[model samples]
Target: MFATSSPPPSGPWAGAARTEPQPRAPLRTDLLDTLMRLHREGVAARETRRLVPDAIEHRDLIRWEQRAARELRSMFDEVGWPGLDVVGEVGAEAAWWCVLLCDRLTAFQRDAHGLLQDAGERQAAPARHLAYLDDRLLMHHGEPQQFGTQHQLFADGCVEPYPVDNPALVAERRRSIGLPPTACRTAALRLLSLTRGPPLDDHR
Candidate 1:
């Protein structure tokens, strides 16, 4: 769910003409490595759950995830967003995955959004990542936006609480940053639900 290409300038800088590539901050290899490992374990834990919902490993996995998320927050506090250049491409992706999967939003939501926006402006991270951050922020604040990663859980199933703003423009937005169309993503989520069954909980 990450974009590879840089997005056009937006926000206060939207009207500025581009001339050169934005410079990136220094890399933090040590922190990047640690985050990468945590991200890998977290993805593994999630996959295990999807494969076997009642697995006894759930508690330990959840604990590991929580601990890793805390570590990530601490790292962010020290070094900001850990953009692709700072953490390397894979590490940045891992950081995004960790943020997305983390159960609590209080830890990194505010600073992460600002840092991600800065990173996006510098072209150190993909535009899609920034969009995802925006979506997460809007969702956390109970507002409506695009790229529907936010959902609510019920006894029967999960439901998207906000319809995308300006449904007609969604595909264009998605395509601008290399994301698949909204319909494709929705169909994929539907197939995943059918295969993996209802999620055990809403971790978002």
Candidate 2:
């Protein structure tokens, strides 16, 4: 389960944790490979499904997502959100991708926001990730989103922001987290995906 004799060296985010409060998270190489593997599986399922949306059944994609969610729940239950310190930057990113693609566990998904928010306070996780999760939860609950990071793609190949709570404040909130403004209209953090033709609620 271990990577090597010693832990991997930290990356550019070595000093990311707060100086006084919120101590660095200890590394857990045992789970690093597992988290990354799950992320790859999820990405692969999405790519293959996208290519033959209609021909393929959703079983493979759903299975991957369910597995990812289950693994993440186990990790979170044992050690809270795995941040850069715990898994290294790439592994931490892999963890986030797993969380983002998790559609089977709505309760765990909501709980993740709090954990990620706390990690963000410690400078252990990205604010943008939390922003995207928050928007997703809001949309899941049938409420307007905050950062407009969720999107809807139409049959005509046009992409639009999911219903946002306050148009006036969205740009400012997005900028605070280093996201592009509503006017800039960058690709959304989460989309219904191109021509997949499933209702957004289906995943929720």
Candidate 3:
């Protein structure tokens, strides 16, 4: 099972306490709207899989996610990085989710994401998602320091692929980016696996 460095918070309200407030920034209405739409679709695709587990629905969701991913890649190509300045708060968050939902990310695209993540962190954009993506790419390449976001599935369930470097500081790293403790994230992933079932393959 997945485990984070911190102790799980107590009580039914524990989860709500972990929610990070979204940063507010001026929106470029058109771009923000586009990003928000993509975000909604991405979320809907996931929800569709959970609510109705039909193979056709799954394939359609995959295609939809892939299309969104490609569009995000194209956007990155035009603009070096979609930071808060370029996309505003909500737009930047949506852009990160679009990339995060991408099933297949190229080396070039991953590198671009890393750059965006770094820039976003520096600019005080919502960066927890970026960190998760960065750590995911690192794990995909068999490198270390994954921030505990990458996992492997087995007959039993999902497990973290590699030990996070400086385990003692995992919570600190997450906290620095306005993320909740690692325990919360790990628990959430476990809940997701239980509800949606493990990935068909170890794509994470």
Best by lDDT: 2
Listed in order, each prediction's TM-score against the native is: 0.65, 0.72, 0.65
Candidate 1 lDDT: 0.54
Off by over 4 Å in 2: 1-26, 49-52, 55-57, 154-158, 182-204
Comparing candidate 1 with candidate 3, which one achieves the higher TM-score?
Answer: 3
> What lDDT does each candidate get?
0.54, 0.59, 0.54
Q: Which ten residues in a row have the lowest lDDT in candidate 1?
A: 1-10
Candidate 3 C-alpha lDDT tens digits along 35-86: 7888777656655333233577557556655577666667666665666677
**What residue pairs are clashing in model 1?**
none
- What RMSD does each model have against the real structure? 8.2, 8.7, 6.6
Please report how far candidate 3 places residue 153 from its true position, in Å: 6.1
Tens digit of per-residue lDDT, candidate 2, span 81-180: 8886687666676776677556455566777778888887877776766777787667666688888766654433345567788789987887777665
